[model samples]
Target: MSHEVIRHATMDDLDALAAIEAECFPPAEAASIYSLQSRLSVYPDCFWLLANGDTIISFINGFTTNRPDLTDDMYDDATLHDPQGEWQMIFGVDTDPRFQHQGHASTLMRAVIEDTRKAGRSGLVLTCKNRLIGFYQRFGFIDEGLSSSTHGNVAWHQMRLTFDEA
Candidate 1:
């Protein structure tokens, strides 16, 4: 991981971010370029990217909200972000196909958790498919059972990593 840089996102990253989102998720699940742009403009600090030299290999992004549960509307609405919110909502954790399983995603996740904790947030929340529950669990996230979110029309389980428990 030497020389691999992790930093907050920028408007310049919109193209690369959108491309990675397309490769990492189904069409219905991927964020549109426009939405990505809006989010980047509104809350760039919440987006983190891991780049191996000049190429982005992975990234994690989301917004903050006082709302404890993740809702579908949060996915498309950048204005929903509240910088002072208690909960940091994770919208996506994506790794490039060519770079999967190389610990990039895990590295990014750790960074997100540490940053959120430092920001004085109460906890971090994310909704993931059943297959990913264990992956998130490794970071101290507890499965809160099925999420009410119907994003992408897929069943998701909400997970939380409370700073108090960490």
Candidate 2:
């Protein structure tokens, strides 16, 4: 692939990121432009973009969390700021349909994993649907079993990747 595949998202990436999210997820799972804007403003370090030449093919966005648990409340309430937190909570990951099966998500995910590790943080954490357990395991994320908190009423699997494991 000729895609450069790495970039720190800026305010200008909002539209592309939102578009990817809309295409890859259900309506409720999609992140709004305003929310993406807010996240970029506070935690640009947690947002990453993967580009194919000039077009954005995939991206991952998240925030820093003090607690180990990936809670549903963190999805909305923006005032719960915690930049000094030890854990990174990945909120959304999406790849444009055209780029599916090309390992773009894995490429972007590695960037986030390294970003968290280089920050001296403990590690990165994320939740995905139950069917995706093995998909994350390939990247070294251990299945922590079932998660209690449900987003948009959909059950999600809580998986974690520790820096020590890498």
Candidate 3:
């Protein structure tokens, strides 16, 4: 983690972000370049990236929404973001395969949680495959079971991390 920086994304990060997304997920699950662009343009502040110098290695991105549950449509629709929404919806947590197991993702997740809390959001929501339930749970996310999402034509489990009122 030496010399690595965690910061909000910019449109300049599109290529690196897309490359990581492709490496970390199958085509069916990976977000398209256009979708990434739209998301970046719409809510760049919601994207947190871990970068070593100019090269991005890991990122956690999502939109804020009042809706309590994650659904399929949210994946491709960047316009749905509501800046003052109660919940931060995590759309993806991607790390470069070369950088996996190095704690970069965890580092970014912690930043995201802290930032979201400071923003006065009620909580965070996300959907993950069965294999990742424990990883997110370590961050205090509670598994809400089968999600309504069919985003990649695969089963997803919804998870939520609600912060205590201040």
Evaluated with TM-score, which candidate comes out highest?
3
For candidate 1, the lDDT comes to 0.94
What tens digits encode model 1's per-residue C-alpha lDDT throughout 64-86?
A: 99999889999889999999999
Candidate 2, position 76, lDDT: 66
- The C-alpha local distance difference test score for the whole of candidate 3 amounts to 0.94
Sort by TM-score, top down from the best: 3, 1, 2
Range of the 10 consecutive residues with the lowest summed lDDT in candidate 2: 72-81
Clashes of each: 0, 0, 0
Query: How does each model score on TM-score?
Result: 0.97, 0.92, 0.98
- Candidate 3 lDDT over 43-84, as tens digits, reads 999999998899898999999999999988998988899999
Indicate the TM-score of model 3: 0.98
Candidate 3 segments whose C-alpha is farther than 4 A from its true place: none
C-alpha lDDT of residue 97 in model 1: 97
For candidate 2, report its TM-score.
0.92
RMSD of each: 1.4, 1.9, 0.9
